[model samples]
Target chain A: MIPKLNIVPFVSVDNMMKLVLSIGVERFLTELAEVVEEDFRRWESFDKTPRLAAHSPEGVIELMPTSDGTAYGFKYVNGHPKNSRTGRQTVAAFGVLADVGNGYPVLLTEMTILTALRTAATSAVAAKHLAPRGARTMAIIGNGAQAEFQALAFKSLLGIDKLRLYDIDASASQKCRRNLAGFGLDVTICGSVEEAVQGAEIVTTVTADKQYATILTDNLVGSGIHINAVGGDCPGKTELHADILRRADIFVEYPPQTRIEGEIQQLAPDHPVTELWQVITGQIPGRRDPRQITLFDSVGFATEDFSALRYVHSKVTGTAFFEELDMVADPDEPRDLFGMLLRAAA
Target chain B: MIPKLNIVPFVSVDNMMKLVLSIGVERFLTELAEVVEEDFRRWESFDKTPRLAAHSPEGVIELMPTSDGTAYGFKYVNGHPKNSRTGRQTVAAFGVLADVGNGYPVLLTEMTILTALRTAATSAVAAKHLAPRGARTMAIIGNGAQAEFQALAFKSLLGIDKLRLYDIDASASQKCRRNLAGFGLDVTICGSVEEAVQGAEIVTTVTADKQYATILTDNLVGSGIHINAVGGDCPGKTELHADILRRADIFVEYPPQTRIEGEIQQLAPDHPVTELWQVITGQIPGRRDPRQITLFDSVGFATEDFSALRYVHSKVTGTAFFEELDMVADPDEPRDLFGMLLRAAA
Candidate 1:
């Protein structure tokens, strides 16, 4: 059969999982982090825009779009905190990467898993610059769907060999601990948030709630550690206390968006925060001193998704991990679409 | 086998063509026009935003999103006028219809053919309200991909029996005339735009040039004629001369968007164009007099695409016209996405 120009390669959820397993999740995260870091180093080349969000009483559906002059990428993601009650994911996503020249979609992939991987990889990349050197222990508060990925990414990228996990629901922490069993990491489930953060060089807060519930207070946080605040991504949803934000040297992706959705929403509008690209490019200082508390205010950005999709597009080039989708209508005669339909009828 | 919540029904180009052909093109246009009319009546209830566009030297990629409180829909479309040189459609599209409650995508489908159908359907619907009563003849200048659809939609919805077609490339008009031969309409291939508009009650200028080209001048537009301007949809791209727009009582889908993209962009910033919805809802008059020159500035809106997607979604229920795509990652335990990947390995 001849290849159709309308066909777009699609990586379904099953195929995405198979691809991840084949590549080894840790290796995938490590390679993806390298791409994310490389993108950050030249972040000035990207066309950045804050996500367009449509908020409802139950959740928010967003379109995060960006382009790096050659490829345009966007992810359709939604966050509905109550979805889990119906056995649905609180956050689900999919994305497309298109050619900027021809404006045809090149890849369509399930981004729910990709989002988790990119988020963890992004956090690891930031921690590599901001976290204390030789950090081997990471206390992950809010052990939910994103917990194990975070643990593994830290292990793969930062070589963190120990994990301290904590969640309000103990079962969540237990599930995370079970998933990390054969990953060569020493995992411990802690009963309290304070117990999880005790004596850890890195503390990652990734709780998923829609309200301003403080999962980490300033009192619980110590100096000389990096904080990966992941869960506080939307307006009115934050995990760290205002006091914690005031104490740490916060860094963020896309300051305009981070100011609205990240933990910095609690701080003054003029509160100074460094852009992550600056640190990655060595334009600004990162982890100024051993005792400095560096916080990565992670609300997720479009470029990160763009990089992840671009990386996946490269990986699935000649692999059986994707199926061609007849997503665009390509008539034999470009201007004879009606004739094409008529021919189909015949 | 259990049904997965991650599965989203996708209508491929083949499936879409089959679905449209199965329903019959004329019937599809008539039914879709009704949905477009119905959506226009409730236009105020929709969450509307101007489309997000990324303009490049080659073309533009845009995301048009809207929601009617219950369901959300968005169309990803591109306009590349030069693409036809490479044997590609100048405009191609695909769209998604998602559930607003849980924010999971319910349907994904190709919109290239659907867009042509809806654009023609919408034009016919507008003409239904604005055109002269008993108008049977339409002169379509620029008979390209959209010409036959426009001709057939007018025939289906307005009972038009005569069509005069003209294109810069006479072969395009010949192709349109050939394709529309058996549709029980009187088709004429005119040598020039002036010849095409002679004795025609409705004139549609659907040229595809990206620059400002006056396909319809003021002298050619006579009284009691409705002008459906379809092709000059982007900024710096318009068909009618400014004098023609000055004489015609203009109507547009959305004023904010029309001011930038439609034919009225040549007019003053505060041009007194009536919103098409108001006329549909009977708040304002569409055609006030028999001798009035009415112009429908047909820059397609997101709501039209939304209505089209919603209609297709309803038609695809229990039908073989769609395939289920595992586009969202749903782990057995919502919090154990990592475990899902691990199990996939097993």
Candidate 2:
């Protein structure tokens, strides 16, 4: 007899870490960046919607869902800034990828680690399209949990060999510098944001505060720098001053979403910003001159989660990194659901 | 040392079935109805929104989410009419209940069985308030998977001792009749809808078709009858004649949702309807007079699922029916997510 189709592949946190290590972090970032870019190039074929978020006093819980013609995916993620004070991670996530034909989940994976990897990879993909040629150094303004991933992703994708890190808490920069040791990059712990971005070609801001605070003022930023802004992802959360946005040629993942959640939320709703997909698809130009500043204001869309899930599903197939979860109910007879439950008792 | 708070309790299909049987199916339905009613009584406290649906040519996939101050819950469900031809269920579901304080999932369970139970319980709860006093006989117009559960819910909740069943396919009626045997209720398989509704105080039409096919007409439904319409729950899909809807005193779960997906989708958008929760809370009268026609047009809602998850969470706290799933990633240092990945490799 054939086995029932009730089993769904599940990737636990340990399994996800193993998968990442087995594939090698740099190689994984490069490959994931390719997948994300590929999805972005064909962005018109997707069913897009802004994430559905439920906000509370502490944080927000969101459901990000999207579908291509054949597959559907969604992620359940939460951002609680106060969680770190209580020994918990500020962000936690999990996602599901399902077949559109059968409406059954094919893969369920923990996405906290994957989200970090994908966010960094997404930033790298945008930088590859918009950053200046032969850029050798990057300044990360907020050296928090995402800082290391951003540093490594830029190294793997763009060959950046130097890093400058700064944070409001100097211990965070020290921890980031210690984590990046032996990663084949010269790391500098700067006392202030202005010192961090002094000579760097790329500037990444990834702070974790839930409030609207300026981590980078306009006068501190120089010309010809590509800004990969990743931290300002919810309402009232931003990192850059409005002057920087006014002077830069801004690009975003999805304009409607970015207007609400990205750093661009500080600007007017009708602010003219190019879509990053347009730049990737050659529908719009990314960088016109070396002196022009380009900002990739990413708010993390559903399609990226979909792409990451598809990539993970491809790698984990027929591998030990995933286990079969009996999540879907498959009865012997289609209409005999009650009978199936009765038989289980006997 | 305190155990990490990363473990989420998961209830599998087998465990859910075992839970239902252990509690006794009738008692389970009765108690679940009570829980649902209790939530309905406090409907003002819930965060309400229409279900987020992604429609496809074949079917629809939906995410239904709601929160009640302290806890949040969401259900992922799909409905496909063509699935039955391939020996798959027409509907499959699963859900998660999480903490509002920390935004961490507490319980993950298969909701296909639970949806069946809750759907039935919701119908019975409506019937208890809307059906004529001492309603003894019920006519179930669709004898499918849900028919038996609806029969039992009515039996346990309202003491409905006699059931008149009818279906387009005689085999479905036979299946329902066979499954409902020895449940201490008189079940009769009728040849037609009119025959089934003969001398019945309550009429339930639950045929599953993806079109606007009317199973009940104006003249066929008489005075002083309570109609529980469950199958008309999607756009372009309804089971009642517009004439009958015009004549009945319509009660609905959520007007915003029911107006688009319930039997009243045939009526005007601004057509006045009574919310079921108002009746449950005693803020509005139910069954205003003996000769009045009352219709409980339930399309299901997120709060009912929230109540069900809350009910399941309450029952399975110390029981072996649930297993711990290492679904969340907890790093020793929340900022060292990469370090957590690195240590897992060794």
Candidate 3:
């Protein structure tokens, strides 16, 4: 027997989609949403900290690493909006899943497309618990790369039927409408953000600008609107107006991180915000009144990545998505790493 | 041209060894040593912060991420010394190199073997500045997987001929000795750490115990010795006793990280160890007298990874180590990320 050397399972982007779709995306999304909620509810088990960032003039590259007692994972992602002009993604990512016991990577995957998928999955999961009862219409402002995911996730998880979309570039909204054509969601391309938010039960601000732009003003937001602020992730990148944040009952992933990264950055340091885990664990009220303007400031936490990785890991098992390349060598002699390399060379 | 979207080069462990050997291990070590010195001298230009570590009961997993305003890199590494008992390497790692300007990953490589190579290269570079002039007869306590690299780096950088090796596991010493058989260095396997360090000019402790089991006591110390404390990285993991550390004038790779994760963690917060950059830049004195003791308290900083990644990136330029998979899409329209996936599905 050749021994179980090079055990880190790897899934390329194409293989990942193949694996996800083989199990059916809707069922995978459902399971992922459930697991995300499960982990978010018990967030205390995670070793939580702010994402370590290395800021450059052009953009910021961040590492979001988290570990429970059993498994450890980290994502290497960068946000460069200007990159799209150069025929590249505004964001590209890859991550590693390691066993906590031996601290070796068990899995590695390309996270460029997975990030958008997981981000929307997390938003939909949060919306299931935080959105107003029987919410059907979702207003998706800043209709861009994340817009389609949000639309599909909302439709898949929360039974959202209608999407009112708006972006500064009208073509972006058109793209969103075209992408969701087969997804069976009634998407309306709005001329303005206010028009997009009109009569929408849930408003998702998933923009790409790396600035504190007011995508949702106070005048546009009405009562009973569940605002999923996903764009305001970095320190200076914000979307919702400070007034809109102040008026709504806010919920966050991690309070310490959300205070600097989420839409709540606009509010005072002491501005009361409930952690989403408290709501999930039934320790705090979630959408107590149907008419309450509730906001889930979804900055895309590490636990979401954890849930997505685990969900994908479970779904992709017994599938041919992994390519077992020679990565970490399990040496013939435990102490002789050099001898293995020498044999490999020979 | 089809327009290559994401071209992050990858070097696996097998290819990495071939790369090191192809580049001539001696020349690779020397070049990487020079790169480390160059990067360290411009310390303030980097995003200098301590690593974000996720500790487990067995070992610790860490993300040592850093950027120098232009290029960014981070190594995902683990230290589970007991893993060898289960037929796994005590350390395994991989890292990414990204363009900080665009936040796009330009390179990703397995750093398990690269780490040991770079760590040894860094220790040798520090020893170049801190060790006494024309020193030979180096004592390497705990001759494990990394001992060969340490021996070679010293041989290449300083022309050191004599090696006094000692390891509790006799097999480990045999492994190290076998790896360096024809590498043109006289190796003598000693019985104990004291015998190995008896009359050596430079002492390097590269043991792999997780706890503060002092491998070098005050009795083992000699005059004019430069101790490269390579193991004892992470809190509560120390190789040298407090008295030995107190007697030796220590230098470290980032004080914040070294204080928390290096041998200096055993010392008080203000227990004065000079940053290696100061010595390299001539701002601080190293080896004041020939009789004075010097110690390079190496906890393996991010800057070294940055330099190593840069070196690997240069060496692997036209080599066939990279696979340009469809990780990030280059659709006709940037907003049609989903459409591209749909088309690929079709």
Candidate 4:
């Protein structure tokens, strides 16, 4: 039987800006967070794999794909540190959502912004389950492009009332403060990583140096502080030092990947760490004491993207993302893939 | 400085059909063949990997990604023999080509149809180099979805004027006959595999069963015949009998992948086979002698998809796909991804 020409919905970056504006960013974040939570709850249903990364001299490009029985999704993302000098973001991405039942792509969306939103939302999910109750203060070190999202997610989800932000580039810190000004949180511009980490209920390090920068040293990390380690997410690129990882109880999205890409990469191959899902599911201990330091090595995983794509697809339904794309050959005759094209020409 | 939101081109199945049709199927094949040949010549420039495949109980899903510094492309494809029974095609795919400089997808297109086109185009390109001069009669064993394309490609590229076709399903053979009738080829409906193989200059086995289907035994293959084996692309899915592969001078797309996914999976890991790229570049021998049995153990590769994506992208330049997607967030301030949404809400 000839499958009718498939119509894939296309979401351009311009329209994406319009859609996010129409949806209201707060409501979008809330909905995205819920989707993240829901998908994480049923994690085993997905056909998961560690993303395929091709490292070059400049940066890296990766393809992340996952599928449940019904639908498949994948994101193509690249990270080039030098891109900023060329007016490009360090990370740019696009993704596809397809019907696994038919193997036809149904939705194609620009994922550069979606990835940022999802990454922040993911950290919030981890922090909510692992952090101390009524956490009110967060120190956001490495206040680059992702800092504001991390700050807002903590504010929206974890009840963070104040942000102690720090960055070597003081302009980035200034930008972070300016961006989060009216986002319903008190902000403090800090002088150093140590100052940022001092007495805060949570510490978030999202520094983007493509090296072992050691943005968070061991001595600064204290008890009862939940550290959302976001930036050290590639092989040879790290933020937390080996001692800090050893001292703090570490949680990861996926062990196989975290071993290579997370802060724990500095630790032993047999380093004891808990999977965040286990903590979320209450299958493992999160924090034994209020004074215990919890470090979530947030390298990200394909499952999170699966969750994010599922969330976006659901929200986009009937929301006018259905710009019909001629992605599949819906021929009058199935065997005539050639004939279909020939007729189209005629 | 915030980069401009990426405008990814969307090529739907319909657009692809229209594009292929407008370009003319023969010209498209000829163009695509040239694309493959040209890329094959610069094989060393690509960051190539034998596609990352996830095998399951039902079938397999694979991500074939390749980049050449400037542009990166990947194809998401699946093979499930049981899918047809469930009202799905046995194979379905879609792909994206992106600017590595910006990490934004430049083109997103459904590859279900494109896959068939590229496979046929690739096989024909191989045949153009390896098939004996003035070869007319081709035996197409196990005529399935790809059978007609194989027929037309050989006819167009290698001047094969007569088709000796056989399928386990008589309806499949009839489909092949009906599809190719407009092409003006001398088509012969053979009853058995042996009958189809007899006296043919080139033999292409494009079967669909996910088993060790012995479509061609050694005894049936005549001296100086070219065997284009296309169906035995995944583990446990093979076409040629062990004796046939053992005797034939095997040619493959990529040896590493062919060892696992092609008919060569039946042979030893150390078994000798020439990569078609080598033959294309004249770095290795294709057919040792005119009387030798030559086999192109074609397990599709990412490089082939790279060639196809490039060809399609160039043809559809300046064409407007759709301007309604709201997927990328661009704000006056790059740091204000959240504020951009907030401003939109206001």
Each candidate's fnat, listed in order, reads 0.85, 0.58, 0.65, 0.41
In model 2, which residue pairs have backbone atoms overlapping below 3 Å? none
Better of 1 and 3 by lDDT: 1
C-alpha lDDT (0 to 100) for residue B272 of candidate 3: 84
What is the Cα-based TM-score of model 2?
0.98
Candidate 1, fnat value?
0.85
Off by over 4 Å in 4: A1-5, A14-24, B1-5, B56-58, B82-88, B181-184, B318-328
Choose the strongest candidate by lDDT. Answer: 1
Give the DockQ (2 decimals) of all models: 0.88, 0.73, 0.67, 0.46
Return the interface RMSD of model 4: 3.0
What lDDT is reached at residue A49 by model 2?
92
Real contacts retained, model 3: 0.65
What lDDT does candidate 4 reach at residue A279?
A: 76
Question: In DockQ terms, which candidate is top?
Answer: 1
lDDT for each residue of candidate 4 in A72-183, tens digit (9 for 90 to 100): 7888888877766655678877788766655556677778778888899999999988898889999998887788778777888888989998989898898888877777
Residue A116 shift from truth in candidate 1, angstroms: 0.5
Q: Which stretches of candidate 2 lie over 4 Å from their true place?
A: A1-3, B1-3
Q: Which 10-residue window in model 3 chain A sums to the lowest lDDT?
A: A1-10
Which candidate, 3 or 4, has the higher TM-score?
3
